[model samples]
Target: MAYYKTNKDGDGCCSHSDGKEHSNEHIYEVHGHDKNEHYGESCGGSGTCRCEDTHKEDGVRHNGANASSKCGCGTGHGRSACGCGCEENFGSLKQTAFQFGTAAVFFILGILFAFIFYDIKLFNFLNLKLSSVFFLASWTAAGYKVLFTSFKNILRGKIFDENFLMSIATIGAFCLGEWSEGAAVMLFYNLGELVQNSAVEKSRKSIIGLMDLRPEFARIYNPEDLNGEKLINPESVKIGTLICIKPGEKIPLDGIITEGSADLDTSSMTGESLPRAVKPGDEVLAGFVNLTGVIIVKTERDVQNTAAAKMLRLIENAQNRKAKVERFITAFAKVYTPIVTAAAVLISVIPPILNSLIFSAPLNGFESFSPWISRGLVFLVISCPCAFVISVPLGYFGGIGGAAKKGILIKGADYVDALSKAGAVVLDKTGTLTNGVLSVQKIIPSKGASDTGMITAEQKEVLTYVLVAEAHSGHPIANAIRKYASENLSGTEYEEFKKADIQNYSEIAGKGISGLYKGKPLFAGTESFVSDNLNGGISRSENSLSGTRVYAAFDGKYLGCIVLSDTVKTDSEDAVKELQALGVKRIEMLTGDNEVSAKEIAEKLKIRYSANLLPHEKVERFETISSEIKAENKNNTVIFAGDGINDAPVLARADAGIAMGGVGSDAAIEAADVVLMNDNPVLIAEAVKLSRFTRKIVWENIGLAFFIKIGFLGLGAFGIADMWGAVFADVGVALLAVFNSLRAAKCRKA
Candidate 1:
């Protein structure tokens, strides 16, 4: 048995840090105590060993197994400790159902008494009828919270909310002797609210199910006794600690494999279904599942800093930032309520006075005022803005959740709105459209040198000197050259370069690396870097090559050039085509790579290209393109996608920035508005499609709510409709709009 510390911030599986009360209980394990002495009947073998002992060092004390405990901070730990928040959600739903059931019974009984026992005189108080008593009971039960909230809000100077509108309308009905209609209105409104809550909870649970990637426990590797490996909380695991990952278990943290090999399933983190094979020394991230073989890993990051944790935090915080449409609705509700309230007052007072004055009829009877007053009450009920206030935000929330399920993280609803209107798309060439992995494609020796097959004696000698220089550098080209040498050189030749002495190693950014190999000056980089050190430059013939060329020089003589290329991603062409189909008018590529390689990729993808641009120049180019696109259509937006730190500036400058999260640098992810977790270019098009669909659903809900409320308001004011019709307009229409908003959560696959 082991003991683990409690999560003080309540961000663990059991407790939610959002300040909502949860019924799930978390048990704090007690160390250095006898289990039998502290065990209680209420423990029920649920793995929670509540202790009677007080631990002063840990600042925890337990009175009994069934009793509550307090932490060092003096906050009591109750039922929020074991599971997710589902239990509390279900409990709330049950309570709403019980209240609705009780109110429904009373309302039905009152109706029965009024219709069947009309002449019978039951118990009465202060001239109140028997039916009136049952109706009052029903209203009190269903509308108590609403009435209390309305009173509190009015005292706080917040009088333009839905609760106030409902309270005034239903209380007015009861004042006019319409007890049954008043009870019915409150009962139906409660029902609608219950349905709305259930829908929202359903969407929340759906997102949780999709993103439940956190590992509960990590096995600490014990080399001396393999069978004695300890299971500990992932958050407690420190960096550089050895951890054992068994087959079928998730890698608990980002680390490099120190031993063994396996195939990993990265779909949870990247949304790609293909299994990637890895050997010792390969880097693995948290949330990736080990498919086969046990591997020992040295942790590089702690639990809270893992990629999975960052994504979860991003999704949770996304809702706090509202879109323009959502802000408009909120502002509309504030002004809309006051204006509608004024109209209701005018309808109640002005119409009857005009009729009495014009027709010369008496204005002193209850009958004359009843008709116009009833219309005003109905108008208030019809004008409640609950449908717009609740459903509009819910619609945007559903969109964000649905996009996350597909491995696309939209930072907020504002980005979703921008993505839906995307007209110009600019993409970085390397690591975005291409694989970003440089590999040796061709190696050619200097002219007049004899060669055999792909590698001659002179080529091997040239590569040996090149490797000695590159071994000191960590650039991607250096790695590619090393890999090629290792696979092609003989065992003795490889050992020769490995043991070669090199000094005065230096690197120039964006050009090449230089070192003194065996006391001879050696250079391996771009044509200018190698030629600048020589009296005469190398031939420009290599510049016509399709891939990037790196020229090497040794002892003031040209040793030849190595052609390295980064292959374009398999999906890049299809992604561009899909963007066109989605109505994106301007599609282009911007790259710091040379003109030859950039043009080759752009031609293959069938889009426009701008080559030989620096990082800042890319941003300037994007701004010019954005201006042209916006000038044509003011609503159009430009989106720039990239994965490197250099691309961070342009990613931030665009109207909406998309980052390749899987392989993207931290700076790019932070500056981006949307992150494609899969690192797949095709997901860019999928995001656009999903955004348009979500926007369509949101507008549909707005249209549905407005049409019904306006039609019913007009009907109620003219005396053609009654309180019953107003109930249908407010509660019925709200429920319909809510159900429609739920459809936005059903995202289609790319």
Candidate 2:
């Protein structure tokens, strides 16, 4: 099979076969390369949207792909087929204001009629009847939707919602000839509904704000026709097409900068405060605003696979994957409503029976039991669990939205729960704790290992052999040696060395690569790989080497070693300290690097480390640690942080997986539960803080709803509270709980 590489910094190691680009980093096999290719088709279902397994960014399948529009009308944008979008929150504040305006008009008219005509006896032509008519108008104005929806739900066989409860209690008041009480109950309930709607809309707005990042169109330039440029929908653009971005325009797709340079405001994508500078060969994601200059970019992925599109899809579908708490509340409400209604029925009937049979009291026809029946109605109204059922999920949604605002993408609400209980975080050393860019630390020639001032002939000869073996590979170590040789060797010497004919190039996974350079054999890889090929002539000790050792063998002779080192990120130490302060019980490092190198980095960061492990062994170590933590505290979670294609197994195995999104492979991103948009280790602590804050808000809402409901249940039982009081206890408390739930969106940095 032939292997081809794509643009340098974009999708790495892509093989073009059968007219499709198979991204090697993501495990997409054009024919049979990828084994786990059962990733299902893209989700266009009601509440879920996921990229298919073995799917490539160049060939994205989205829900909106079938539709020719992006109007949220079942086109492939992953939205439901509703014309108003899936949410009913548009202009909610204005709708509430309109309802209040009409209710106020009717209430004032009814009050004037009662005070001037009925109470004063001014107009005696059925003044009480006329006053009742005005109050009825006020009640209709405030409670029309409640009455209509309750009956609609009843006809549909879906009863016992909050609207049904309010409707039955208020109508029961009117039937008992308490017209003013009935009107007042409906009025207060409607007011509470307005408050609840407004608060919910406010929380939802925090998420909807992300929609502003989607670009309207992309400017494409035609290279064949020099003067041809067209503006088209971003979704219509294909991969590998060149698009021009002018200053002040938002980037419409993920691509590589092919021409020009500029500063880009990437806060919407990564939440970084400063603008990033981009030159040719730099990768750029969608939703960033180009601050200055014109840059031509070659699109690397389709619109559906862009970062902005994925973020939007994840958020829109978050509510469908209910958290455990949310599912429990749903089940509880289903049982709670009927049980409370049955108890209310018993209270209305059992007292009458006991009074007639046991006490031998005088029994009037129907009026004797009217007061108890009215109290039972009040009990029914107070029993609605709207506050707990509605506010808990709303709080979690707010938390998810808030985390997205900070550039952390949590796939589902359940992961938010797992993050709250995380006790240990396992970090991969190469890209998670340190920048993965390898640099040449030292070069030792076998003949003149101590030469420092000038490059000798033997040193040039050794470098020439290593360069020929590494020229066709894209590994970081290979690039580092190529870079070192290009900078150290003179132009004439480099060109002369590069002219050597190489053939039969092949790579050995986890070891090194080999080829025939100038018709003689040459190889580069780990120390063991090179020492095996040298026939007992050379055995260099690698214990003294603190960094990665690249050994080279040329024509059955040991050519010596090149030491390459990767530097720790500047924020790694600070990130560790922050996680400790945030109550992470254990922090550990896992890496494939040598013991000396791994221990040096781990000691500096003050964390435990497991060194010299393969990819599968990392998962085994994590499982053992997780089992021990669970034995101590069943609620404790283990989170794994990694950034390579090899890290996907451990990433998916952990309780909560955190990936360095900025430089991570696509497989790692897909396997991770939480993705930190920027490669900053400190964001892990931030995600934990957000989840804990959200959980706090959820419990507060639950506690407040129960406290008020319990008090009102007692009052309704004892005949101390009327329908008007029940309305305040039910609807008013629900409104207050919703307002408290909005606090989840206001989480601050810890």
Candidate 3:
């Protein structure tokens, strides 16, 4: 006896009398079971076998008094069992090829018979000719699927599709004694459909191949049992678990390295070809390949929350968000088809009736109405809306896929349209245009006014107090101050400052932060913020500093200031120039720094500036700029790029938001429509150029399809074109438009 069950490893296997688990490759030999019994239900039906067998047979069959079976073991099976020798069941592609070949042979024979034996009679019923017999056979073989589908659609209240149009047109051709043209129409249409399907499949494969970064399994690290590391599904791993990644293996989850270091290839995540060297303390995201050394990473997030998973989800959902042009084409097809079908019906009846009355001819026989009905059939064939319906959304899908290859994740086709029309670009001062890393440039002590060579005693006190107050803050400026203190202060002094008790901590947005230390008020913020609360205000200097200055005050006495500077990114100036060269009319910068510092950076890039603005003020400024640009041209849009949490509101309020995914906060990324995987400001310009290219290709397809279709529609209506010409107008135009839309997938770099 043989029985099946799921093993501990979740594999479906069967146990025989030998007490050994046999895989599904071995056939089960059943004894004394009735041939008509439904054994598939006990074995989980056809094709649902968890053993991953190829057989999909549902029931047992007896061959020479012996019954053989293949089962799903416990799952819901789908198809027939393997090695069943079922030659009659062929796939759709094979069936289509066979039918087309047979039709082509019959069609050629019919044309030959018409030329040599035109008067030969094949049958007595209705005086069918020899050529007509072959023609009827060719038509049946070529058009059976179309006729069947048309009938089924009519029953379902769907009478205005390509199948219905083609079926009616070809059948009318046969009734009018145009037998050769009728068969040729169906044959050519099927050929065009085959070419279109091939092109669409190629485009889909090329686009989806760019994102092949999913890791198969993760190795659980076991230091105590180093030789026994088990490989399991990445989704099964929990947070804080230690996972080992060997060289040439993909990092399966977002984590921080705890043991060894390696050179990581982050091209799949960031689209940068250079390999980044990572140390033990460096953070790593999922989908990066380890290049050199083995590293044990402590997973920080579950598999679903990794960056790769989120990116895949974004791409999968992108098709659901349609562009305005795509939506218009879809809606137009729905209204256009029924109207054209109605027009074909009127053309068939009215023209014959009017001729009979005006010329005093009888319209009782098929001969009197044949010419007008043939014209109506031509009209019906030319009226198919396949070209516009298939190619419009396909163009947008190719555009999204092209942008994704460059590591720029656009949320939808609507955003692609918005990016192409960018008129004014508003960039945040830090992280967007300038590197957000800040370093202490200079220190000034109020007590020693002339000490420029070395740090004085009062400067040390100021640095220590600033470090103590800003230790718990997570802002970038606070983190910079802490780093500076750690490197400058001695061990004893750093430890003493870290141990100082503090209470009543408060952080005022965009200005500064304050806390009470040892029952004394301490402040580390802008010069004006510190000077306002002090008993004696500091002296105002006419010479403004080049970088941001954070003033320190304690116990109603001013200590000094620390000037921290952030360098502009190497690609910022080039990116700005490229945007201008691309015909962007306005480029501006928004910052919370002092006007002097903001102006210095803005002048270097030669753009306008708005300084001393809070988060809400930044949004208001963006709105004003957007309105001004739209007033000039309503199609113009404003885009904002930022990386900090405070920039989230402005990022959401702009016409299009671009987030620097490398150093940007979660809130900023969540609010943005486009995300640049790396902190390269040049990517913004690249994205604009790509969007324009994609839009141009889409419009080109639309123009080509409309021009060809409209010209043929007029020709067919006036009897200048035949059914063969109508088939070319409908199917030929669709194939050409589809080929043109494929160019959007191969976007050139700007």
Candidate 4:
């Protein structure tokens, strides 16, 4: 497809489609010197001319309202649009209206509550003639809606729902002559449900927002007998077909740069805030924004199997997984509800039956015992588990959304709970802690070699010729070498080389690349890559100092070496020190590189322990560390910080895995229990602190509930507290517990 040079909206020029009413004079314009024009006409007989005065030709255009269906879009002069117009937006007017409806429900319930607790019994005094029947009827209407909804789900073979629990509890209240209390409980619960419901909707919105990263379609050029060119979808755009991407548009597929260069905003993929410059021959990822310049990229893969979509699919799957705590909660609730219901029944009936044998019991007081029996029913009503059932999941929902605001995403509540006990940490050196981009530190022309002396002409020919030959390969090291020449050495004549004619060329996937240039075996790679390719008659420095090592070899001999280094993340060293201070006994560095490079990185980060290991080797190392921690100290824990991709298995294996979620792999983000979204490693400390805070809050809520229940029940058993106070012990404590538990929902990372 033919890409447009610029958008008309941006240029403010009247197109042929705009009609003659807006002429070139009336329309505002800004232009530059047209290089293709004649010097006399364009520059006005001089070296400069006003670009705004350049006139344009206008003609009739095809009659179509939208620019998409006709003109350059449908006619193959551009890309096909995949526009939703509504981006990952969670805030909208409809959402505001929903909140208002929730407020109305709470306001009405609040007023009804005031009437119940008042001395005049304002609304109740009017119901004086209606008696308890009117109270029962009011509750029946409200309570039965929940009852029917649960019944419908049950008939459809669904059970253990929170709705079922509330239905049963409200029915028990009506049977106990606590009709007013039952209605009020349902009213308040509905208010809490409204809040919980809103949170769940927001979480769903968070996930949906991520899906917008995937492109729906791409416009392709189709040559046919009837039409010279036509627009097509990315699915039909085959490999090697040139795809065009315009400014402010997402690239439809992954490909190597065949033509053009621009600053690409790839924050959508790598989460780096800066725009990365991409020129011809550089690899461009799918879903990156072309900020400027028109780039024509050849499709390297089909749209369906693009890495961007795969990453989104991984995130979706992670949300379905459950943590150990979540699984236990599910099983515990299943049995706890049934056992308590049976106990409540025995409490109401058994004591009354046993009292029949006592002769000393007052005959006049026998009637009063009925109200006490009814008090037991009110306890059962409040214990419907509605708050516990709904609020627990709601807390986790809020936690994930809060974390996303800070760019951290934990898959589930199980991860949030598991992060509290991070004991050990593991790291991958390059790309994790260090900026993956590297620059050359030194260009050793070789020992005892200088301009016009020290080395023979044969050696000079080999050095200059080999460097240019290797640079032809278009690898990362080659680019760094090219950049070095562009900066320091510019006067030397450069030989144009091609890959197809190069003899004996070979590529190693995980290591590096090498080939023949002018029949001499030329090579460039890490110390290991160069060492393996040469017999090493000339010894090279095998030990890497400061950072990573790169080398060059020719004709089974070590020629020269280049040292490249990546800058460490700003907070990496301090975060490591903080974790060690927190009593983390073991800190390991795992990588796909050799021992020397890994050790160098570990020393810089001040990590006490280290492991230079492979992808699978890291997993084995984590297993040993976790077991050793448990053996030495019962409370010892193991934590791992890694890229979410290759280290995914190890991430899922550890006691706690904290992914550099913003800078690392998607696989690690999905696998780890905790995520450091801001690329600040100090978040590891913050997460541990927050996890401990949440656990403390949970225990506080539970303890407070138990203390109030035991004290108030003891008072009622001895006739010190009235039935009204007993009800407060149940309802009042519950509201307090729910509110207190929300403190755990706070995400410090956000």
Off by over 4 Å in 1: 1-95, 111-131, 448-451, 472-474, 490-509, 514-523, 529-534, 554-558
What are the runs in model 2 whose C-alpha is more than 4 Å off? 1-79, 82-86, 91-97, 111-131, 184-188, 222-228, 446-448, 456-462, 490-505, 515-521, 532-534, 537-542, 662-665
Give all TM-scores, in the order shown: 0.86, 0.84, 0.84, 0.67
lDDT of 3 by residue, 1-750 (tens): 332323234343333345545333332323212212222222233322333332334343322111343121111122333321111122233466677788889888888998875558867877778887788888888789889998999999988888888888888888788888888888777766555555544444443455555555689999999999987657568999999999999999998999998999998778889999998878898889999999999998886678776666566567678889988988888788889888888887888888889997787877767777888899888888878887877777777777877888787788889999999999999888999888887777666444456666777888898888787888788888888888788888887886677799998887787889989999989878898889898755523668887888998998888888899999999999999999999999999977888999999999999998988899888889999999999999899988878888988988779988632256866788888888899989988988888888778888988898889888988889898898788888888878877787777643
- Candidate 1 is scored at a TM of 0.86
After TM-score superposition, the amount by which residue 341's alpha carbon in candidate 2 deviates from its true location, in angstroms, is 0.8
- Preferred candidate (TM-score higher): 1 or 4: 1
User: Model 4, 560: alpha-carbon shift in Å?
Assistant: 3.6
Clashes of 4: 6
Winning model by TM-score: 1
Q: After superposition, how far is residue 279 of candidate 2 from its true place, in Å?
A: 1.1
lDDT of 1 by residue, 605-654 (tens): 99999987867789889989999999999999999999878788998998
User: Would you list the C-alpha lDDT of every candidate in the order shown?
Assistant: 0.79, 0.75, 0.76, 0.55
